[model samples]
Target: MSETSDAPEAPGAAGPPAPPAHPGVGRTVGRMVLALALGVALGALGTATHRTLWHGLPVGLLVALALTASTALLCRAWAGLGTLAAAAVGWLVAVQVLSMQGPGGDVLVTHPAESIPSAWAGIAWTYGGVLLFGVVAFLPGRWFARR
Candidate 1:
């Protein structure tokens, strides 16, 4: 009878070693770029159409909220995590842009002290609505997801 080998295969010898568990750097970078681009486009449109409406809110908040909802709806496969991540990334990018702008830009200028509370309230209105849309995206069914 022939002797059987009992040794296990080496780590490097496995069939084409499974690709990295997390997405590749290239893929991650691509997603970030895509998300940033989407945020900018949406922000520009939102700013243009709702200049007065957004005047009461931080652009970062608006961009975050909008991108979150849109990403959630578009990439249902990723669901909650994807929506949150996209929103965060979009917000970061928007914040960077806002910071680079002059003091008169949407994010930095301060209105009346008494109006501070109301301004925050307005920001919450748009921000909450957008976030709610993202949450809805996680729900079942296509029609339901679309908003």
Candidate 2:
């Protein structure tokens, strides 16, 4: 006579296998902070990638695209959005108030208080990166919503 072997199974087994345990709070926070830093760093570096009059527009747009796509791929939705937001705010503060300069040694942007009409005439270029970032931030959300 031969003996038969048996295996254990869940009752009903109606659901898919469970996912891995969630990350800890500290780890999540750290990742979020890192994401924010990555976006900001991209902006700063991209800004200096080229130096010319109103160079911020093109460079900034490139930065926005790179930062958004990279961060969204590396980070979760909330963290990625937070990173983009921080990048935009940081860029604004840096160029507008801190008077940060581009590679060519000209200030990238100015404080709006200087005179919106005049200061904004050619100053919009500095915001291209942040604006693009904002626009890209929605893409991930939409894609995730489908799943």
Candidate 3:
């Protein structure tokens, strides 16, 4: 009588391990949401504490720009710089529009030309601060991801 083994055969050869899950989508979305939420919350708090913090300093605008820039950077896509530039331009345009909506739309419209320099200055400051924030956030983000 031949003795036949009843043992099951193992995998022919352990197939290449499955690729690691792409955490990019979840990480990017989570970071974007958290950044926006934080920005809004901080803007509200700053506004409450001192309206000037939000109005005169353009903190909200800067925060929005920085968040936009960082989100694009984190995506590791080709559109990062373009997105940042576009956001800056959009913010500048929005500022112009808001300033034009002055009290009864009278003050600004009456002196639109005069307000251009100041409006541009404010936008410059906002974009500068946002760019700085993006640079600061990028390194730390990479470092954190490495660990």
Candidate 4:
């Protein structure tokens, strides 16, 4: 009769264990900074550049994409950062909105100086960016660590 022994597998025996399902504090903070930086860059782009036939579409679209991807990475990297993630995105949106305003303006925020309807549309577009970020950061995902 053969006897089996209970023992742990050696390093690499399992072919490198999966990375942690949740990122640590450093990683979370780093990602948050990255998100903030990207937001700032996009905001600057909107402010520094003139709106063409493309209008603010290029800036808005880029912001939406960068914010969504970075915030999603933050949430997926760490599971407990729902509020933080959402708030970070909100802050990003706020910065972008405020950037739209000029040095001396009665209104809260405005971009490219459009008419009433177009201005309203721009505001909606800004919020929609936040919404997309929130959806990606808050929605439950299918995959998680085995822990």
Best-matching candidate per TM-score: 2
Could you give candidate 2's per-residue lDDT for residues 15-130 as a string of tens digits? 88787677778976676667656655655554444233353445444444565456544443555455556655554543344346557865544447756333552344355555
Runs in model 4 lying further than 4 Å from the true structure? 1-24, 43-52, 55-87, 90-100, 104-117, 143-147
Model 3, 11-116: lDDT tens digits are: 7745678877766766655644554444444333322222123446756445544444454454333223333334334434443454344565543222325555
User: What C-alpha lDDT do the candidate models reach, one value each?
Assistant: 0.50, 0.53, 0.43, 0.53
Residue-by-residue lDDT tens digits, candidate 1, 1-147: 998888998878878656547676787666656655665555444433332346555565566456555655554444334534564456445534543447655543223453654345334534554566456545766554424
Residue 72 of candidate 3: its Cα lDDT?
40
> Candidate 2 at residue 138, lDDT?
59
Pairs with steric clashes in candidate 1: none
Off by over 4 Å in 2: 1-17, 50-80, 90-98, 101-125, 145-147
Q: What would the per-residue lDDT of candidate 4 be over residues 44-147, giving only the tens digit for each residue?
A: 44333312226535554455446555655555555445434644554566556664545676443344454643354345445655666666656555443335
Candidates in order, TM-scores: namely 0.40, 0.51, 0.31, 0.48
CA displacement after TM-score superposition, residue 79 of candidate 4 (Å): 7.8
lDDT value, candidate 4, whole model = 0.53
Deviation (Å) of 143 in candidate 2: 0.7
Candidate 3, which segments miss by more than 4 Å at Cα? 1-6, 9-16, 20-55, 77-118, 121-147
Error of 3 at 63 (Å): 0.3
Candidate 2: 10-residue stretch with minimal lDDT: 47-56
